[model samples]
Structure formats: structure tokens, C-alpha cells
Target: METNTEPQLPYMPGLAGVPAAESKVCDIDGQKGILFYRGYPIEELAEKSTFEETSYMLLYGQLPTKEQLDGFTHELVHHRRLKYKLIDLMKTLPETGHPMDALAAAVGALGMFYPHINVMDAAQRHGACVRLIAKLPTIVAAFHRMRRGDRDVLPNDKLNHAANFLYMLNEQEPDPFHAKILDTCLVLHAEHSMNASTFSARVTGSSLADSYAVVASAVGTLSGPLHGGANEDVLDMLQEIGTVENVIPWLDKAQAAKRKIPGFGHREYKVKDPRAKILQRLAEQLFARYGSTPLYDIAVKLESVMEERVGSKGIYPNVDFYSGLVYQKLGIPMDLFTPVFAIARVSGWLAHWMEQLENNRIFRPSQVYVGAPPRSYTSIDRR
Candidate 1:
């Protein structure tokens, strides 16, 4: 079939080979190597706003006043407890199930329990957002405890989001320094215009499904190594390399064999990912406050080598590089790294769902189908 050669839409700047996700909000100036969230620079928000505050700002277009933030915090803490039905469902999962898999299943089950979650109603949507933000820690902690045959740790309402999550996970209230690190890490991971997971959410919501349904699908996407689990893999990569001395040969050999670094090369920002810088600072703080760990040394050495090796090719760390170190240092098992990402990202995922519903258009992008010409079916006996 002959087809018109002229492009229907304006030629898009990036192709599928690149790592760009097309969400209306955030943009990265790869040439200048700058990153912005809802048009606000990451550094500005990182400096001025708390994780909770930034999350609220991203969800609502405007930043919340003090009283509104207080109310949101109160609401989040008040609902931190799991619903009885949800707890019962969690009890049924095999203890061997991966925490990420378990959380995805539990969150999806929540949608069935409250199937009427209105994708359009701001209040109802915020209710879902609050539930996800509050309860993810509880679910994650419970899964961890269950796997290890330990008792569940309940949430403490008096603490902040970062402290409360750490408290629940560790069964002890974390000190200010540790909580602060977690707060910054969560803020860094909060939103990106639309990644594979966020786009998965939007695409699912385009079908007009409830927010939970879309988020559940997105969680599955985030569970993948290429998307969110790269943090865990980076830790694994470092562990396998074992020392600063090993960094060079491992990287050179991987490069020689044509392997892309797990934590390098973003599709949107050709220069570097802004979130990587934020996480790198947190990792540095953790390393500086506490005496050195071999993993930290390995990462630093790898960074220097990789920068010299791949700087011209635009291969650099994304959000995953240092996140594993934080979790590992926090005494969190390596298995739960991506689940932590999901916990923080639930806020952004719901924010996008709300955005999608506001002037609702189904997310149906046309495919450029390239295929064989129409032909008749062959006869059954034609050998």
C-alpha cells in the first residue's frame, strides 16, 4: 500500500531510542544539563521545601500554605493504619513473596475494595493519594517482618513522614540526621514528568480506570530493573566489583563488550540526570557523617572512571546510583529498594492521575504501523 510521506504531527524532538517520557509538566535542558519540576528547578525546591511540602506542591499546582500543609500532614498520619481487610489480604501472601510484588498486589486489592475511586473528584483523588502515601510504609514494613518471621511494626502519628517511615521499618525512631537524609531522598524521587511507570499510569487512566488501577500497573513497571530496580542492581554491581581497584576493569570490560551501565545514560537529559546530583549529595552526607564503607569508596571510584570513560557519550548516573547505599546503610535489606521508590512515587502517580482527569482525554497515541501488504490466506495443503 502506498502511503503519504509527509509527517502528520510535527517531528518530535526525541525518538523511542532515547529515554524521554512525554508528560506535560517537567522538562530537562540536556544541553545546559538542567532539570525542572513543574517548571520549578530541583535545587530551589530541594533547598526551600520539605518532602511533604514539595509533594503537596507537585500534586496541587500551587504550594500549600502552612495551615494546609498541617492539615495534610494530620490527615496522612491519621490514616496510616491499614484497613482490616487490607491487613487480612497481606496475611495471605506467601512469606516468600517479594515485597514489591506483595505491595503491588495489596494496592491493587485496595482498588477492588474501593472500586468507585473517582479519577476526577479532587477530594476523592486526594483521599487515595493520602492512603497510598501513608500506608505504603506500613505495607512494606509488614512484608519485611513477615518474611523474617518478626512482628509487625505500627506507624507512629507523632513523627514526620520520613521519620515515621523509618520508625515503622526499623522499629525505632530514627535520629534527625537519618530522617533528614530520607526526606531529601523521597523528595528527589517524588516526580518526573512521565516515566515508563508514570506513562503506564496515564495510559491506563486514559482507559478511564480508577487511579488505583493505573497506579497498580505503574508499580509493576517500576518493579522492573530498567526503570526503578536499577538501584538494587547498582548495589549488586558494586558488591560484585568488591573494591575501588576493581571498578576500572569491570567498567572497561563492560564497555568493551558494549554493555550500558545500569545507572547511566538518561534519555531526557543528555548531560546528566538532576536527581542523581541530589541523591549523590545525600550519599555523601551519609558517608561523611558515618565513617567510610567499602561500597561508598567503590561508587566514588566507579564515578570517576565512568565520567572519564563515558562523559562525551552522555552516560552518567540517574536516580538509582546512590539510593541503594542509603537503604543499605539504613539497615534496610536490598530487596526493598524499589518498594521505597514506589512509596515516594505514589504521590506523583496520583498527581498525574488527577491531572489526566481534569480535562479528560483518553491517552490513545496513534501507532505508525509498518507491516506487510494485504494478502490472501494460503491454502491448507500448499506445502
Candidate 2:
């Protein structure tokens, strides 16, 4: 037998622009700043859909009917309670631990409690998906309260998903306007096709890993600053700018030093991100209700300065730009920003995991070997 010895193809750094899989889950037209899920425009979904409804659409591939949604919501609400052992495990984590770390650990622990599900079975997968969607916010809220030495605020079944999370975190019922804002945020963050974390989920699922393990891999991936953590960086940058007047000078210095502006650019959208557009409008409404924060003013000015400097180069405000500011106004701490992203994005992660199982193939791309090849073996003292 003879092996083919053809030269390897040129390497593409980061596998940019590669088509790893075919998905009906979501689509993005980067140039036009358009995003869609199941062939429906993002704008329409953000305007009309609740996070629960959007989560259903992502997981099941269609918007649920009123009856279906009611049943699904009931299931989610009931499953919000975590096993006591999971809460005990979260307590052992250092208070300084990042929320994403606690979340990944807790999600991985879920497999131990719910061990009977068969990953290959569709019904079992759906059950796991619902549990994860229901429980993540509760886990996040538990860790948040424990870290602050506050008494744990259990989930409120009477409220919707977004509102319940706020109630648990704040230990007070969320105002209707605040709850609605957070719900829209969740809908916007629910899914994006083949993003870093979603790709991580699919890769783990391709190995036939269980749903908990698949989501754990994604949580770890999302912990990276370049992914889900970018919003935290954006908020920090806005605070450092300090005032609207500092925006122009700060942009100049940052550009001169070749420093990156956290939220001013995105790899996918050449124009403003569609989610950012929606969030910007939400920010306006929030400021009107809660009174404007200084950070929001700085963020707006920063965007204007960034546009003048780099707008022609296809750099613009991304989802992270306004999302952090919105979360700040909602009384969320900066560190918890990425964990909130995880809560919303778990729907998408599970969707990709299920999709990967439907057409399972192990991802094994070859690498171009540039190091010494076919070297002769040498004895230790040969030289």
C-alpha cells in the first residue's frame, strides 16, 4: 500500500471563513448587518418574542403555539430549583472565583444527579435541554448571592424566566419595565450561528459527550475574554474614559498606542451589530425610566468618536458596546456580565449540540506540519 504524499494546503489562521457545518439554526449577512433565526429576521424576533419563546424556537426549530408555549413555560418554571448538593458544591468555590467557573462546575455536576438520560434519544435530549435552560439562571443567581454573603434568593415561579432571575439576584420583585428590558436582552443573546462557544458545544457533542459535558465545554470557552467576557472589558473601558469630553482624546491615544477598543469592532458585522441596534434603543428607554448613568453617556460619546476614527474601515459598535451599559443600568455587577451571557446563550449551545448529534461527525481537521519531519532516531550519547 502507498500513502498519498501530496503537500499540505496552506494554513488558515483561526480557520477563519471556514464552513464547518450546515445549519438551519441561524444566519448572518455580515455586510448588511442582518441576522435571522429559522428564516425570520432578528429585528422582528427582538421586537415580538420573549426569551422563553425564542429559546423554544431555537431548540425545537419553530415558534411554539400558545398552548405549547404555556406548557413549556410551566416545565421551565418548575425545574428552576437545583438539587441541594449542587448548591453545596457552589458554596465550596472561592468567593473570588469567576461566575463562569462556578457555572461550568455546577452544570457538569448536574450530570451526576440526572444520570439516566440517553444522549442518543431525542426525548431525553429535549428533557436535558429544558433542565439546563431552566436551571442556569438559578445557578448563576445562587453563586452571585453566596459570593456577596447574601442569603440565597430562591427562584420565584410566579415570574417569567428573565424576571425570576432578577428577583433572585436582587431579592426583590423586578419592575415591569426592567423585566421587559432584560427579556429583550435575553432574546437578542439567545443564538448566533457557529460562534466560538456554539462551535465548542458542537465539537463536544460530536464526540457523543453527554449534554452536561457539552454545555460545560461551552461555558469554559465562553469564559475567554474574546468571547462572552468582552462586555466586561467594554464596561471597564467606558469607566476608564470617565466622561464624554474624554472620548476624543482617549480614542486618539488608544489608536496611537495601537490599543484595542473593546466594543468598537466585531469580526462578523461590518456595520453596527443588529443586536446592538436593538440594545441601543433599549438603553434609551431604560435611561428614561431609571435616569441616565454616566457610563451610558460615555458609551454614546465613545461610539461617535470611534465612528469618526474607524467607521470607514468597517469598525462599529458591536453587541458588547451597549449590552454592558444596559446591564449596568439594570443593577447587575460588571463581573456577572458574562455569566448572564451564558444564561441566555445556553439555549443556542444546546441547540447546536442537538444539531451535531442529528448529523454526527467528529471534527478532525489536519494540520500543516512545518517542523522537522522524518528525523532519524538518535541514541542519547550519539552526539
Candidate 3:
């Protein structure tokens, strides 16, 4: 008999409240419904900063000076175009495939082009960061247009990051109001403290994998319904409710049936998610700009009803709750909701990816075995 020598440690289901790595990238105070990136409040960043600048802060760990911002923005703008081969690759994917699937594959392939990516080289790391944050939106928008049998639009250098993405997706410049709202959405979503996808990114990056592989893994994690896909589900839920009047009855039925409602609860946030509050405001502003949709009305009613019923339970509307309403009003297709989330989140993933490399350690968490104990093997003919 072999003697057991491994240390016994308590097993936590899903690694809840486990600290995996130290990071200075982002922080969340779920109790207070506050989020900060590099010590700056998310609300301030969303209101006063551009996605480009916010992305810069997340990656570099500080606000950029005007000159620094210009250089960084220049790099992002210049790197926005994907190689033609990548576009051709997207053409081969089935139109029915999920956007996230296509995005993951394309990003993985994108890494293949940079086969010599040296994580140890600071210059190379900076290039990789710039290229990824620059190109993700182009990848998402290009595939979207291609799947619809429309020609892909080239990056418009004249536009800012958020506006340029909206331009590529729609083949026309978006209204300033729409672009500003979307920029705020991106800032809100750019980073969250150690989320599921960010954890996946860190895990993969800890293996010293290339940036693309790290991000691709994170994209795959985000595709799950409980994570980035919740915004899409929120839209589906809103459509199913059909009208504002149906909100309370639907909640009553869903609650009584014990069916989980999408977009209402967050694991990190005990109070109403701060991002959800901002997004709700953006939804209202968007409604005012483009005329209201039935979905927003229903969402409003649903929030009120949910508050009356479940607010005391620390289950409240999270970021996903109102984001879909805002995106829908912007004319983004429901399925692309998660892909857009990926575009914004790539910054956070890359930031964490770089941080993981700084103090790289392969994750090797111990798991308690709960299966049958070792049994002696018998010869085939003998029981």
C-alpha cells in the first residue's frame, strides 16, 4: 500500500472567495456597488474618459497624459485593420456558428501569425497589447457583416474607438449621442475585478501562453450563459415579456416556478450593480434619442417588480440587465451582444495577461477525490 503524503486542504466549490493571484488592475466593492480601475472610480472613467483612455489606464496602471494618450490612441487606430487572410478565414466558418465561437477561433489563428511572441520583451508585450485591443472590434464587426453577406467595412481612422466600431458594424457613422453612450458602456465593461473570464485569462496566461491564446480562452469562458451571454438572455427575456404590463405577471410566474431570471443577480454584487444603474440611464437617454422601445419599458417595470420582491435578498439587477436594452436601441443584433462584450473585455484580459506573466506560476490547485478507491485489476477471464 502507498502512503498518502499530500497535504489536506479544504475544497471550495467553484473556488469561491479564493485568491488566485495578486493584481493592481481592478477592484470591486460589491457591498457598496462600486468598481475601480487602478484606483479610479468606474463612474468617473465612464463619464469623463474615452474607451481608448480607459483601456490605456487598465493596461498601463495609470491615467495617460495628453501626449501619452495621443501616442497610444495613434497606435490603436493604426493597428485596427486585420490582415486579409483573417477575413478570408472568417468566410469559411458556418454562418450559423455562434459569434463567440468564430471569435475564439479567429483570435487563436491570429496568434499563429505571431509565432515568435516573446512575453519577456517589453516592446513585444506592448505591441501585443495594442494590437489586440485595436483589432478585436474589427474582428467582431467584420464577421458580423460577412455573415450577413455584406462586404466588410474598413476601419475608419477618423473615428474614435467606440465610434469607429459602430461605424464598421453599421457601414455608416453613428450619431454622436449613440457613440457616446456606447463609449460609456465600453468603459463600464472594460474591466471588472477577477471575473470568471478574467480568471480564465489569468489561468491560461500563467502557462506562458501567447496573448491571443489567453484572450481566446477568456472569450470561450465569457460565452457561457452565466457570464457574457447574460446580456443576450436579457434581451430574450424582455421580448418574451412582450409589454410593460406583462412584467409583474411574468416575474410572479417565473419566481413561483423557481426559474432563474437572467440579468438580475450577480455573484460579486450584493446591491444593484453600479454598471446596471449607469446602463439604465444610458437606455433612457437612448430611448429619448431614438424613440422608446417596448423592451425598455418592460425592463423598467421588471426592475421595479424585482426590487419589491427580491431586493432584500441581495439579488438585484446586475450590469447585464440594462446593457442589452441599450445595445438593442443601438441596432446591434441580439446574438452579437456577447461579442461586443468580448470587444470591451479584451482590454481587461490583456491587462491581466501581462500581469500574469510578471509573476508567472502555473495554477495547480488540488482537488479532493470523491470517486471509488483503488481496486485490484483482475485478468480478463477471471472476475
Question: Highest lDDT, which number?
Answer: 2
User: All candidates' lDDT scores?
Assistant: 0.80, 0.91, 0.90
- Each prediction's TM-score against the native? 0.91, 0.97, 0.98
Worst 10 residues of 2 by lDDT: 1-10
Candidate 3's displacement at residue 230, Å, is 0.8
The global Cα lDDT (0 to 1) of model 2 is 0.91
lDDT of 3 by residue, 229-309 (tens): 888888889999999888888888998899999998888899999999889888888888779988887888898888888
lDDT of 1 at 316: 80
Cα lDDT of model 1 by residue, 208-289, tens digit: 8987788789999998767878888888888989988888888888878997677777877766677788787877788788
Error of 3 at 377 (Å): 1.6
Model 1 per-residue lDDT at 173: 90
- Sorted on TM-score, best first, the list reads 3, 2, 1
Candidate 1 at 154: error in angstroms? 1.7
User: What's model 2's lDDT at 182?
Assistant: 96
Q: What order do candidates take by lDDT, descending?
A: 2, 3, 1
